[model samples]
Target: MGMTLVRSLFLIIHQKMSTSSSAILTPVGVRGMNVLDRAKFLRNIKIPVLKVADEKLSKITPICKQYFLKLENFKPVQSVSGEKLKCIHMNPEKIGAWTDLSEIDRKSLKEHSVNEDNFIMKDIELSYENWSYGTIFKAVLPENEDIVSGFTQVGHIIHLNLKDHLLQYRPLIGQVLVNKIKSCRTVVNKSSTIDNTYRNFNMEVIAGEENFLVTVKENLCNFTFDFSKVYWNSRLGQEHERILNFLKPGDVLFDVFCGVGPFAIPAVKKKCKVYANDLNPDSFKWLNHNAKTNKLNMALFKSYNLDGKDFILTVFKEYITNYCLGKEKLEKGAKIHVTMNLPAIAVEFLKCYKGLIEDEELLEKFDCEIIVYVYCFAAGTDVLAVAKSMVIDNIGCDISDNIIDIFDVRNVSPKKEMIRVGFKLGKEVIFSAKDCVSEPPKKKLCVDN
Candidate 1:
């Protein structure tokens, strides 16, 4: 009876096996063999298998030694089989799979997942791009994606001009900027345009400290001022240095609108005499402070709080007269430079230079020429032409194209540009008795308080 049963099982397997499954099926000759031989044949035979659901397989896969099912072992079946299988076949390992992973690697796998969340999965390190404002707030506020890169830093303060759409996120953006910049301790957003003669705009603190007083270093000199009261542009550091490079020892500089002594103190440090004046009393006060702080002699550096036209007529005219009529004759290399930096109305002061030294004998006694650096705001496509016309029209004299050098300082807005038109004030332009204008042309007046 046992032999018959064994024979029947072999017949059933032989009938079910196909040419592809022949490799795994045992030879059908177990009916004539002994009971022990029949058992040995059954143990060596292989059978087709099917895979369980992935979730179910995962639960048992860790503990079992050979629970994996191979793709080749699976076949289409109309119904479930009753035969019990003791072993399973596995396919080749899939890509990125850890074939050597054991039940002991559970702790390591957990650590890898955590590291992925913290962005340290690889040896390469994360950079500023990973934590930039665009990356961190891109999903929450997509409109302010480019605002982070447009900030200006004044000493320890970060100045931002945020649009209306970004005003809601000002605090959050300011906090991120402070965190990113190591030296910044305060962040402020410009609340209004710079319309006042002092070139100061309203600002509100967004992060960190509330103080507006900042000390900035430029051209190796330190300047301290109240940012809310005076005008100070960190972007003009290069312009200050460029002007400084043109100075020599014993040279005299008249800064008509020297705010916080950005140009005057540095010039004094370079061994040049400076007559720095500003209409803003706050700027004049800080200019004195900065001059002293930079170890400049008060005798060589003079500070004045007077209107641009008044400063030229009083202190500046007196200085030129004394230099021309002094015992020591004016040196050939010595230069007199007048800087008018208030771009909105600085060009209007050019009329003040006409007949600045009325005494022809006193002007003729000096061998040096007066060089004027006048700044102006020009609009439209023809900025150079507009700037040239402004100087010629205000000075009431025809200036040669070769004598005037126009420098594009920067763009103030989409339609406006800041320009510096530097020219040598000819003897004819300064001392000519014809077309002499005592006062500048009528315009919006800037008064000293």
Candidate 2:
């Protein structure tokens, strides 16, 4: 029988699977299978597809398997439900194509005439067609304007701003002006070269001050933290908010890369102690300023450059692993949780702890979960190629292969593709201890011949 048939039969018999051991590769035939087709097949079946009838399949099924089902309903609590908006990219100049007056779509288009002047299309000719589009132009809100009404009529966002060209984008234009106004208010507002480019405005660019701002609140039970300084406000700031929203009262947080104390201060305000660590000398200066400015009980700020390898191993050993033959320390209390936002560079760091994890007794320590937000770049190649290569290279690691499909991938830079890989590690040292382990699957994966 085919592997898919065998696996399907196995699942029908077994309800649960051990997620740690066993060959878990999805058979090639099943890999490209469409969910809709599977659903259709499932509907016609009398027995639930999950109800299998084979003994051997049951033995191996649980070795490396877990399943999750989601039911969504519109409610206040469901606000965070990941509902995606569908879009189509239509060229304004090509509106006549298939847009006959008799067509209902053409009538809708006539009723809602979008302003082409407001739309931005570079050298490309503006044409209208049923092309996929994903993004809406929300109006730029000035500080005093009500943010809800700030958005103007719906206009399809055709293109995103390049890093260098962001100054032209309305949102970034406002942000840049605001930043410029703030910098001009500083005492030393004068032209100076910062990182090769000369700045026209003057500000005390202390360790962290340039990257962070200090603001105090009145009658506030707890300090409020803001991450307005980050260069990429929309993407990174959204991520920062997601992490902060998870905080609770008295929950100690350690932001290893506590750049402007975004995570640290918020945790502290919630009556939780925080340990903020960052190697950037500039970051600490602002971190201290913001803590004192907000009148928050300043938490510890460790300013040493944590060698990435050392930091990862330290986490794996102290916070993660426990039960090692010579070492047995529970990562309880405040130390139980740690935050590391640097996923792009974390793979390199995982190398150091390869040996310590091999000891099973110590493996249980790592049972504590990690919320890693990995960022990857395709480096101008196809995204599938990059993703497949990453999976094959990081072999033996107990990552949820299916979990990778849950990311919100976007083309941040033309030549760079971004993907976030988040997973919970098992209590087993899956890393190979052999030094100079040859790289796995370095070449691009070309699925289509």
**How does each model score on lDDT?**
0.64, 0.34
Give the per-residue Cα lDDT of candidate 1 at 405: 83
TM-score of each: 0.67, 0.41
Residue 158 lDDT (model 2): 10
lDDT of 1 at 346: 80
Off by over 4 Å in 1: 1-130, 144-150, 327-329, 360-363, 434-449
- Runs in model 2 deviating more than 4 A are 1-235, 247-254, 270-275, 295-304, 321-339, 343-346, 356-360, 364-367, 379-398, 401-406, 409-411, 430-449
Q: After superposition, how far is residue 37 of candidate 1 from its true place, in Å?
A: 76
Best by TM-score: 1
